[model samples]
Target chain A: MSAFAALVRRDLVLAARIGGGGYLSLLFFMVVVALVPFALGPDLNLLSRIGPAILWLAAVMATLIGLDRLFQADEEDGSLDVMLGASLPLELAILAKVLAHWLTTGLPLALCVPLFGLLVALPAEAMAPTALTLLIGTPGLTAIGAVGAALTATMRRGGLILAVIVAPLMVPSLIFGVSAANAAMGGTVPFTTPLAILGAISLVALVTAALAGAAALRGGE
Target chain B: MTATGLAASFWNLANPTRFLALSGRVLPWLAGLAALVTAAGLYMAFFTAPPDYQQGDTVRIMFVHVPSAWLALFLYAMMSLSALGTLVWRHPLADVSQKAAAPIGAAFTLLCLITGALWGKPMWGTYWVWDARLTSVFVLFLIYCGILALWRSIDDPGRAARAVAILTLVGFVNIPIVKFSVDWWNTLHQPASVFRLDGPAIHPTILVPLLVMAVGLSLVAIALHLSGMRTEILNRRVRTLTILQADHPSEGGI
Candidate 1:
């Protein structure tokens, strides 16, 4: 347990010090959200109507941006080889990395949804639910991203490939996350149904990513 | 046969050299069978199957479309099995099979999408709908493309195989989720349609031709896969020979 915590802490510190970590993702998320208003013009109603979707989309994209480095850096420097050889199970180590990724990237993206929500003219009533859905959904994004990251970690110029591989998998999360927010915003479907499904997707992604990511890491080696 | 007996027979053919030799003998026969079956199926489709009561001539496209859709899903299933072979058994031919099947799968998926759109134009009044079934198939197409791209990007065949196998497994798990989400999404937005393609009420006349076409397509797909595996095996042999020649230039004069 302590080792897992230490691994997470080490990744967190590394991300803070690195070039493409928390701050970069936050900036990218903000930029994407900021661009939505300009693209849609000054239609507040349209912006508010689509606010949840835009936020969710930006959060997903932001999570993907940082994923390429999730294992690539360790693989490059030989730390991955050592980790693979260690007594620490690869799946647990992957969970730690994903947790750190969510902490630095997903969590920040979710927390900033409300702030970015204002720029998109998100309705006041939907802000809490939009943030809530993102908070639930972004871990799934990180988990899925980790699988893609592991798959492509050994390749050169893997960023685009990782995005391609990961994006389709993200569809469920996006669908459920946006639906939950829409439900909370007065859609006929009950808010709880989609919300529960969204949470289920996160749990499934977590298990899938850990097992698949470990296998991928071993396979790539 | 018992489970062990079946597995032993499977592993017997898993050797790449043996597979190459065996596939070489079978390829001509398989290709001929594929050609004959497909010709027969096409004849029945065009000459035998009656026009639909509602769709008329447009219903004929279903002969091609439905089979391609089935092949698309079928090839993915084959790849997933090969993925299991690659990961669990480390079968030598598993990677070759997975790599060979990807582009074929993608092509079938594209065919499925285009034909689906063509059918939708006359039937649904729009060529495209964010309807659940259509959307899930589209996602399937994207997944196929992603797997193909992953296969191409990695240089090492062994490493690429493992990575691709893992990705394939991940995609397999998500297929059901995609289907469910799209189903739920469509349900929330629109009521179920009265005329689904695989509806329970298909006429025997139409069903026979559809089944024939489906079998024909499966044969053609198998022929194509066998041909691809042959090419992949040859490519590996060529790669090995080239490396050997480079190492000992005097022994083999280019």
Candidate 2:
């Protein structure tokens, strides 16, 4: 347990010191959210209607930014080899990394969704649900992203490939997240239902993706 | 035979040289059978199957579309099994089978999508809808392409195999989620109409041809897979030979 906590702490510190502590993802999230208004034009009604979806898409994109490097840095510096040789199980190590990633990237992205929601002219009623859904869904995104990162960790330039591979698997979370937000925005279905499903997806992704990512990391070696 | 005997026999064929020899002997016969079956299936589809009461001539496309869709799902299932073999059993040819099967699966998926659109144009008055079934199949196609891209990007076969296998397994786990999400999304938008639980309600005349076409397509897919495995095995042999020659120039002539 200490090793797991230490691993997570180390990753958090590394991300803070090196990857700008989620500031980069925040900037990227803002830029993506900013582009939607320009592309769709100044129509507040349309923006408000699709605001939750836009925020969700932007959150997914932002979460993807530094994922390819999730394991590559360790793999390159030989820490990954040592980690594999450590008394700690590979799956637990992966869970720690994924947890750190969610903290550094997914949590910040979720936190910023309300601000971006305002920029997109999202309805006031939907902002809380959007933020809530994102908070639940983004861990699923980072967890799956960990698997993609591990799969492509050995490749030279595998960022695009990792995105291609991971994006389709993320469709369920995207659907449920948007649905939950829309439900909150006065749709027929209750917000809790889809939100519950989104939470289920995140839990499942956390477990399965950790196992798969560990297998890929070990298999690559 | 006992379970171990069966397992022994299966692994015995997993040997690359043995696979090459066995597939070489079977390829010609399988190719001929595939051609004959497909020709007969096409004949039955065109000549024997009567037009749908509602769809009329447009119903013919189902003969092609349904089979391709079935094969698309079947191929993915086969790939998943092969992935299990690769990762759990470490069978040598398991990765080869998975790699060889991906593009063929993708091709079937594409065919299914195109034919589905063509059928939808007349039936639904639109070429496409975000309907649950159609959307799920589209997602399947995207997944197939992603797997193919993964296979192509990695230069090392062994590493590529393991990576792709892991990815395939992950995708397999998500397939159910994709289907369920698309179904839920569809209910929010519109209900599904393609196929339903109490059976399709298609007539025996149409059903027979559809079955024939489905069998024919399955045979063809199997034949293609066998030939692909053969080519891959031969390619690996060539790579080995070239590496050996490079290491010892004097043995190059042999």
- DockQ scores for all the models shown? 0.85, 0.80
Highest lDDT: which candidate? 1
Off by over 4 Å in 2: B1-5, B177-200
Candidate 1, residues A101-167: lDDT per residue as tens digits?
8988888888887788889888888888888999999999999999999998887688999999999
What is the clash tally of candidate 2?
0
| TM-score of chain B, candidates 1 onward in order | 0.88, 0.90
lDDT of all the models against the reference? 0.88, 0.86
TM-scores, each model vs. reference:
0.94, 0.95
The window of 10 residues in a row where model 2 chain A has the poorest summed lDDT is A15-24
Show the colliding residue pairs in model 1. Answer: none
CAPRI level of candidate 1: high
